[model samples]
Structures are given as structure tokens and as C-alpha cells.
Target: MAPNQDEETLESLLEASKTPEGRSRLAASGAVATTLRHLSASSPLTLPYLRLLRNLCAGEISSQDSFIDLSGPDTLASILLSSAASVEVLRAGIQVLGNVGLAGEVHRAAVWVRFFPDGFLRLARVREREVCDPLCMVIDTCCSGVGGRQRLEELCGTDSGLRILQEIIETALKAGYREEWLEWLLFKACVEEQRFLSLFLTLSSSEESSTNLDISLTSVFKPELLTTQHAFLLDILSKCLTERPKEVTVSGKFALEILEILKMIYNIVDFTTRVNAAIPTGSPAIDLFGCSLLILRDICAWEDARPTETDKDSLVNLLLDEGLLDFVLSRLEELEPPAIVRKSMVKEDNLFPVELEKRVCPYKGYRRDLISVIGNLLHRRKRVQDKVREKQAIPLLLQQCVVDEENPYLREWGLLAVRNLLEGNEDNQKEVAELELKEPITPPEISGLGLKVEVDEATKRAKLVNISG
Candidate 1:
């Protein structure tokens, strides 16, 4: 028969297989075996045949059984392994394989027996959405159930396999494909199994030159891909930290995970600020650092708000014990005063400072994000309040209580932090009252707005009282 005629015939069969009665009839008629018998490299009939078989096997045990019994995987694997398999052909064949694998253990075992490490790894490198999405399905299905744990370990056992998985994630993230499956896979491997650290360890151990893929472990976690390819990762990592069992979250079990996350944040910030000074607007570093801090902030606030708090430590105390407070203070200190304050300084000094151009946390709103974490850490917690006081962060917190064009809501978060610090602590309030205030320096804009900085002589406090009257 002519190729067009053959394709039309297969298309009709595919439509028929969409129904249960048709699927059963097609299975009984040995359609799967017949299709495999005609499978060939560069054949125009290949994709149509695979499509028909995929529709036949989808959610139908009888058709799935026929596909396996007729050595469908063997023929499909050969087509995939061929040098001439078109993207469409690979996509259709992998979809069929995914459907078969989704049936049961016996079906998945048959698929896995044929593909295992190499076949799937080869397909994973395609980077085409049509191929990668179905391939993800195939892997996800095969790695289901208790026995599939071994298959997962084996897939991740080889560096090549791990790189393939990482690239697949990067591809999906960049292209916005099949996020649910990829998210679960990463969550299982990285959080549930702690494969995230393992990936880092592997990268650290291996010579850096061996990272041959478009995305490397370093690129995936660092600022290299942060701008374009880290939304999915940030969301998944945030969920991993935030959605843990409350008990485990507080029991010090999360210490290593928190530390690793803190390390990622520190490294990214360091790389962005020190190694590379040019921060892309809306950089993913903001999302990366912001996500980590938000997780810490929420967890701390949650623990602080609880009426019956666990005595088994806490995420806040654990983080504090890990020097998170010190980290926040250090980063805050490094950030140049926000744009508004900088403007005031430059105008008053009649000179633009070159140091302002090289400010750390250069991305907009970064300082406010840092202050937010501190604000949450201080929420109704006296020990945290005392910790902040002891660390001499009171003055730093006070600085945040001013309008900064770059850091939106900086003044509000700063005020809340100060309130938390002195809510019931007379010592802290008295210390603030006694601390000497610098004579106010009014920038042209503030003077232009009929505003003046007024310091209360009795309390030695500065206030932005309206002098418009």
C-alpha cells in the first residue's frame, strides 16, 4: 500500500482504539504485533503506528498486555535507538511505553527491562518537549511503588544518569513542561532522599571540567541559571522546607537541611555580590535568597505564635544557633543604605559616592527582605529580642525605620522589628531612649517637601514630624 494510504489506515485504527470496545477488539486482533512487525527506521508509517498503539494501550489492561506479550518494547526500543528516529516518532513511541508502564508492575518491569539506564538516558538528552515530557512520564511510572526505589537509586547511581535527570529538570523548567512530575521527582530525590546534598557532594568531588551538559550542578544551584531557569527549583525547595512535619521541623532533624539551604543562599549572594557585580534586574538570586528567608521567616513566626510550643528546640532557635542572625546582620550591614538615603547623602555632600555603585544586595527590595526575616524572628519572642540586643542589632534595626526608595516597606518592617524588640522590655526601650542621635542632615528633596528632621532632646529620638504648619 502507498504510504499515505498506510498512514490513513493507522490513523483510523488510532481513533478506534480510543474506545474500550475498540481497544479490546484491536488487542484481540493482534494489532500490536502487526505494528511491531512493520516497525522500521525512517519509515513514514512509524509515528502513526506508534500513535495507534499508544491509544490502544492507554488505561486498558488487555491492550497493554498484548503490547508486552507481542514484544512491543523490543521493537520500540530499536526504533528509539536508531539514528533516524524523528522527534515525532520518538515522542509517540515513548508515550506508548509510558502508558504500558503505567499499567502494573509486570508491564513496568517489561519496559524497564528494555530501556534501563542507557536507552532512557539517550532519549533524555533530546531536549524536545514532545520527547522529554513523555519520557518523564515513562520514568515516573517505572519508578512507582516499593520495588521501584531500587530503580531510582540505580538511575541516580551513575553520574551520567544524575546529569540526565538534572538536565531534564532544567529543560522542563526553562520550557515550562510537566512541572508536577518533575517537582515530585526533585522533592523525592532532593528532600525526601537528600539527593540535593549528594548532587552538591558529587559536583564538589568531581573535576569541574567534566560538566558537559548545558546545565551543570553548579549552574543549576548558582546564579548562572538563576535568572532564566530557577523558578521551579525555588518553588520546590520552598515547599520542601515549609511543608515538612511540624515535629520534624522543630526537632533538630531539619538542621542539616536548613544549613545546606543557608549555604546555597550564602554562596549565591557571595557569587552575585563579590565574583560578579552586575546583577540582572529581577534576578533569580532575589527569588533564591527571598525564598530561603521567607521559609525561615514563616517557620519562625509559626513557632513563635504557637500556644503550646515544642520543648524540643525550634526552627528559629536552630537557625539562630546556626548563626542566621549574624548572617542577616552582616548582609544588612554590607548593603549600602537604600536609594533614598543615598540620595540624601549625595545631595547633602554635593558629591556622588562611588561606593554606592558597588553596594551589596544591589537588587531592589533585597534589604527589606532581610529585615522581614528579622521582623518575624522577633515576633513576640523575648529570647530572640534579647539575642538581637546582645548582638548590637538594635541600631541596625532602627536604621530600617526610614523611607528607602529601593527597599519598599523598609520603614514598616523596621518599626515592627523595633516594637518587637521593646514590646515588654524596659531595658531595650531605655537603651534606645538614652542612645545619642546624630544631628539631622536634610537633603534638598526633604527640604523641598517642607519636611524637616526633628530630634527630641529629652529622649534623643529622631522623628519626621511635619513642619509644613
Candidate 2:
């Protein structure tokens, strides 16, 4: 038989495999073994044979069995790893493997045993859409089960494997064409598979990360990817938290999943804060901290956004029960005064430097973020408001109502937090009313703006007024 005739035969078989009966017949006819044998016969016949194999195995368990039984995975992995193979051949081979992977756990394990940790990572570096898209499909399928997921963890345990994964994520984020499979692969590997800490460590491996806060995580991971995943999580939690109590109730399993996710976020925030005394001004850790707080704030707001008359396991209540409010308050107490306030209080004549706390929240808007979380927690929850008064947090919050250069919007967030703390709570309002009346400290920025803090003798309340008044 001529080579062209063989190509024509393979193409015919590929077309026939579109039907279920055709696929079953093709699998039963021992044609899979013949194609694997001929993959190395000539470069010209390889693509058509691979395409035929791919079509046969797609969504067909018997055909996939034929491919695996005939040692097709090993043969294809060899071709993909061969130096003589062209990009076109590699892409087609990968598509076949991806199809085989879609069958089930057994099929996926076969593919992972051959291509993973090196073959797949190498192909992933090719950077072409034709190859990367199918590669992503293969990895995503392989990560769908316990065995395959364990194999992925092993692959990522190596330094080279971790680097390759980072490159894949960074490239996918910056690629001209968007691929949903790549996103799914990342979510599977990082979120579902619990590989986020590993991937995060890989991204933070740069030495300058220790000294540079201005460097964005985009230097390693793309912002769009982070934003997309965060939004995805927020949307899911919103739906879960805001469901009407009468229609359907939030389940325990889902609540547990959400609690675990919240714990992870809190750990990231806690870990970053503890490791560094002064987080760099624009460091990735700072963004991570801010993002974590923002997620917590949004979750709290969504949990309280719709109040139910009946007692259910609410996320806000769960957060409070977990002492998230106390945690935030304790963190706030550890932070050094914002840069602007600290500068205003420094005495020019004194030679001694003020000793600062070792654990400092150095990021811009750190105060505002902490305050935002408190504000959301206080929303429609009288217990949180009363807790704030009991904790003596009201005075600390009032102190935030000054113009601080470092924490943008600190004043606004402070006002909002105070409002939420006192709303519908007479005890909190009375606590604020009984506080000693003292003049507010004027930062240089406020003084430059002709704004001065004044105490009204009649009302016995402090207010901002023009210097002329």
C-alpha cells in the first residue's frame, strides 16, 4: 500500500469515528495498534494517524481502551519528546493524549505516568496556542481525580516543575487569545488541588521581593488572572450567603467549604503580616494583604446584606463566632501610627529616636482596610457594635478620623466605621457621648488645607472648621 493511500485510509477512519457505532467498530478492529506502529514510519502520516486516534478516543471508553491497550500513550509521549518532531506533530499528538485523558481516572493515570513532570511541562513551554490549549486540557483532565492529583503534587515538588508551572500561568495570563481550559487547569491545580501555596512560593522566589514593595505581583502572576479568580470566588460566596432563608437554606457542607476558604485567606493575611515587620511600600505581600481584607469585607457585607428572621448558620455570625473581629482589632493595635501622624509628633529638638513596634502594618491604607472590615462587620449587627464599645475600640476608631498622608481615605473609613458602630445601638452612642472632649491633632496636610479641628462648647462635640472661624 502506498503512503498516500495509508493517509487516505486514516482520514476515512477519522471521519467514520464521528458516530458511536463507527467508533466502536474502529476500536474493535485492532486499527489502534496498527496506527501506533506506523506513527514513526514517516512524518507525513503522523498527523492524520494522530487525528484519527484523537477522534476515536474522544468520549468513547472502548476506543480509549484500545489506545491504552495498544501502548499508544508511550508511543505518543516518545514522539512529543523527540527532537525531530515538528510543532505540528506535537500539537496533534497532544490532542490525542488529551482525548484519552477525558475517558476517566484509569485513562488519565496512563497519560500522567508517561508525559507528566517533564514531557507535558516541556510541551507547555512551546508558547503556541495550537499546543498550549491541548496541553492545558490534558493537565486539567489529569487533575480531576485523587491519583492524578497526587501525581501533580509530586511533579510540583521539584524546582523545575514549579518553575514550568509558573511560566505556564504567566504566559496564559498575557496571551493574546484567551483559553478557558488554561484557567480551569490553574484553578484545579491551585485551588481544588491545594497547590496555591506552592505556586505562590514560586512567584515570590525573587530576591528583590524582600526589599521591594513597589513591584506588583504582575511581575510574576497576572492581575487579570487574580482578579478573575477573586471575582469568581466572591460571586459564589455571594450567592451562597444571600439566598432567601424560606426558599432554600445554606447547607453544612457548603458552609464548611466557605469556612475553610476564609481560613486560607486569613492565613495568607496573617502569614504576610507576621513574616515582615515593615512590608515594602508596593510589595506583592501588601497587595495580597489588601486583597485578603477586601475579600473578607465583601464576604461580611454579603452575609449581612439580607437579614433573615429565622436563625440560620450565617457567614457573618460564623465569622464573629470565629473571633475575626477580635483578630482584626488585635492586628490594629500592633500597627505603628501612620507615617503622616508619626512625622507630626516628632520633636525637632530631641536627639532620641522613638522606639517603634516590631510588628508594623506598613502598607498604605492598612488602617483603612482594617477599619473597612470592622465597618462591614458592624453592619446590621448589634452584637458587633456593642463588642466594639466593650473592646474600647470606639476611641481608637475616632483617632482614625484625622488626615493621614499614608492611609488614603482613612478619615472616610473611620467615619463610616463609627457610624456603623453607633447606629441603632444606644449603648455605643452613649459610650461615644461620655468620652472626654479633647482637641483633635492637626496633621501638616490638614493645616495646609486651612482645616482645623474645633470643639464646640455648646454641643461639646468636636468638628472640623476653617481656620478663619
Candidate No. with top TM-score: 1
- Lowest summed lDDT across 10 adjacent residues in model 2 is found at 274-283
What's each prediction's TM-score?
0.70, 0.56
| Error at 224, model 2, angstroms | 22
Per residue, candidate 1 scores C-alpha lDDT tens digits across 1-469 of 2334566677778888889889888888877777777777767677778888888888888878888888888888889988899989988999899889888888988898889777887887687877788887788778777567777776556575576676676667556564356656665665555455444434333333454323434445645544433444545655655665352233343344544565565665642352222223355655556666655665565534554555423556777788877787777876675555555555345433435444456456677878887887777777778888897777667667777666678778876776777766666666665553333343333443455544455554444445666
Q: Report lDDT (Cα) of residue 68, candidate 1.
A: 86
lDDT of 2 by residue, 313-393 (tens): 275677678777887887776666555556655545242234454355545567777888888888768888888888887
Candidate 1 segments exceeding 4 Å error: 1-5, 19-31, 169-178, 201-316, 345-358, 379-382, 401-469
Clashes of each: 0, 3
Model 2: clashing residue pairs?
Answer: 213-282, 213-283, 214-282
